[model samples]
Target: MDTRRPTIADVAKRAGVSKGLVSFVFNDKPGVAAPTRVRILAAAEELGWQPDPVARSLSTQRAAALGLVVRRDPTVLAADPFFPAFMAGVETALTERRQVLVLSLVPDAAAETATYRSLAAHRRVDGVLLTDLRHDDDRFPLLAELGLPAVCVGRPDVAGAFPVVNLDDAAGLRSAVDHLVGLGHRRIAYVGGDVGMLHGRRRRKSFLEALARHGLDPVGVVDTDFSAAAGARAVVELLAGAVLPTALVFASDPMAVAGLAVLQRQGVQVPRDCSVTGFDGMDLGRHLHPALTTVEADPLAWGRAAATVLLRLLDDGRADDLELPSAALVLRSSTAPPPDPPG
Candidate 1:
């Protein structure tokens, strides 16, 4: 049996290119022609040659990893259904490139900034995936100062040079609102996440616009922390009001699910007393007693797209912004026509 590891020299010879050219292609450095790069890669693949991680890192001055820091309570992150699915999507792309994900959850902005600075200063990650963007996000400037590459999961109204992977939050809200309006719901309420968040503001703005288009006014609007517990609280506040709305639109499935439990406990029959709709069509929504009516925005796809963009930026020093699938309304048993008014 012949057993010998293939070397770069062997690959270069087979590809009819110099060893320097092979190295350039493997390192993903600029100045390599497209055809030559393809030939070099094919030759390396044909020889079953995989770059040694340690050697590659040393030569490339890269960490071969990415950073993701969530500015939320660890408990909140653990209970929130979206993070797990989204992280899985990110891992799918990272696995393909043999990259590592350094994930952390912190309590406040100071901690989040510190985490980013530490990662960049220590050369622990090649890039980062920024999530939960705020209206006046400071991370963009910080990242620029750190000279670390990044991709935002949400589009910021403020301009920045970094690529973004964003979904159509406005369109999704419009669809959700339209669905409720179509179901003979005249007085619709909106339960949204923190208004400080970029997407939260966007969703609320869209909701108001949607209501205007239908010549209706919002019965109520409540903002919460995007947690199940917070959702329950919001529902309680709405229920305690002078007049109850015919329908409620929640910003997240978690909140909607929690609100459902609240309604049931309060003896309010879903879709009879009031129709409920949620954003973020997580699998958990389907398993509910009455499947949730929701705006289906795939968090998994969002994560994958964000990771892909960051990876591209890391490799080539440039990447175009990506727009993932627009949000679609998923009709389920949670919503129905408003009950006939009592004469």
Candidate 2:
């Protein structure tokens, strides 16, 4: 009976599979058959064989960990359902690789950049996943100069030389607009996240384009910090506007949920007095009083997909741009036709 740390070759021999197969399964790479993956895992467990992450990193001259720096207010991160769900998906991928996820929550862009630089200088991670992209993101060139490989969650205006994981959300945005228009919502208002953020701008653009496609004009637009409080405040402002919009589309589920609560407090009958729509397809939305109507974007899938690309880049030195599953619109009781006009 050998009483020593097992190596990749040992696992391969025990599993009766090639070393490459074992590597693929451990790294959660595609193209490995399900049965083979199961067999490999079973063999490794039976032999008490666990890959040493530190040893592997030392030998490979790589950190064997991934970094994610979120430039968000801590309150928003706690309130928003997307970040948690997305991180769960990232964990699922990291679990197989026995890798670590180094997450940093910063208040602003300055702190965020410092965090990235620190991570790179400390050799704390092999690559990073950049989220909450900003217009003319400084992280792109900074990361490139640091020699740190990265994958952007949203398509930056200028990718320079990095692989991006872009979700086709245009269809979902269009569907949302079309849904509102069908409900006799001629005056549609948009509540977006920080216009400076790449996703925020992209979604806002999509919302406007969707309206144009249906031959409707935007009645109002408000930008928020993607916080519940911000959402509530924006809702109040929209409701107080000269020409009240019958439908309000929010950029994220948390904001939408906040807006719904505000509407309820203000004696606004949802889908009766005014209708609301949210994005991010959070499960919490389904349990809301009226079951929120929203565009469904799977954060978990986004996380897993982004992690997959980052891992591939680490392994192969280079990876191609990946198009993730498209977002779609979900209909619920939150949206309805406007009330009849006075005769």
Candidate 3:
């Protein structure tokens, strides 16, 4: 028998066992005795008969790869600071197990469905991690139909048996709005995110709920795509109104930064005249002229949790609906009570 590219027969011959016995030992079947299994393994090592992972998976009807599907432009995802941090956490968990992560970005629902179907049908990945969940997302039903093990990154409005991992957005937003109210802000406006997204909807709901709890009326709500330019234009619109809000709660740090610039251009002093608060407590927020008063959500931790959950689903077939860590309100220089009305 050739030393290189040795086959199972070579291992069996070297171990002084039958080929079937060698197969049983390598496959971890109980038919082979402990001593026989050890001998076969030793012989296989000597012959460098490393089993092909793909072939093994096919024989066992299992795949060791995990899939991650993001519903956004791939290039934009790379530029976003939060996603990179989150991905690092996911990689850490997968690295420990020596598993592969297959990531894909689908711009629309049709593309997402096609990609998912291909992965599931071919068993390319053992499970999937779905991000950017929208209200009544089309992916949810499709995942169920495919019987694919999957976990979502946000809470779905409709309850399903699939796994989910999400941040405590409601509590985080409540704390942020309450903090602003405590600062003596009377007229507060909300610069919302894409209302169709689950996280954005939750944040908006929390904002209104907190305002109601504080016995304050909602001043204005501007729904905009999550972009710095959109946030800047929304702020300008608010400023152009006859009655400008004294405080604003932005859905994201980038938006808050953009709003801050617009306010500065109008010669409005932060905290002294108009207060600002941001979510997603990104590092850039801390470096702002007035440090942003924001909620701190650990994206890395979120990623790690999502990866772990997906892996667990694959390994044990134990689907878990997990809630990841929530953000805490961080009081900074960017927020304060509204200035007294001119007499």
Top TM-score hit: 1
Which stretches of candidate 1 lie above 4 Å from their native place?
1-56
Q: Score residue 114 of candidate 1 by CA lDDT.
A: 94
Question: lDDT tens string, model 1, 1-343?
Answer: 6598998889999999998888888877889989999999999999999788787776686888989999988888888777898899999999999998999898998998899999999889999998888977999999999998999898988989789898997898898888888889998898998888888888989999999999998989998988999999999999998878889999999999999999999998997888999989989898898899999989898888899999989887899999888989899899989989889
lDDT of 2 by residue, 1-343 (tens): 7777787888899889998788778766789888889999998898788767775555565777999998877877898878898899888999899998999999977898789889999999999998887889898889989999999897888846888988877789889999889888898999998888888888999999999988888889999888888998999998898998888999988899999998889898898988999999999899998999999989899999999999999999999999987899999999999877659
Query: What TM-score goes with each of the models?
Result: 0.86, 0.82, 0.85
Candidate 1's TM-score: 0.86
Winner by TM-score between candidate 2 and candidate 1: 1
Specify the highest-lDDT model's number: 1
What residue pairs clash in candidate 1, if any at all? none
Give Cα-based local distance difference scores for all models: 0.90, 0.88, 0.84
lDDT for residue 266 in candidate 2, whole number 0-100? 89
Residue pairs in candidate 3 whose N, alpha carbon or C atoms collide under 3 angstroms: none
lDDT of 2: 0.88
Error of 2 at 1 (Å): 34
lDDT of 2 at 324: 83
- Could you tell me which 10 consecutive residues in candidate 3 have the lowest summed lDDT? 73-82
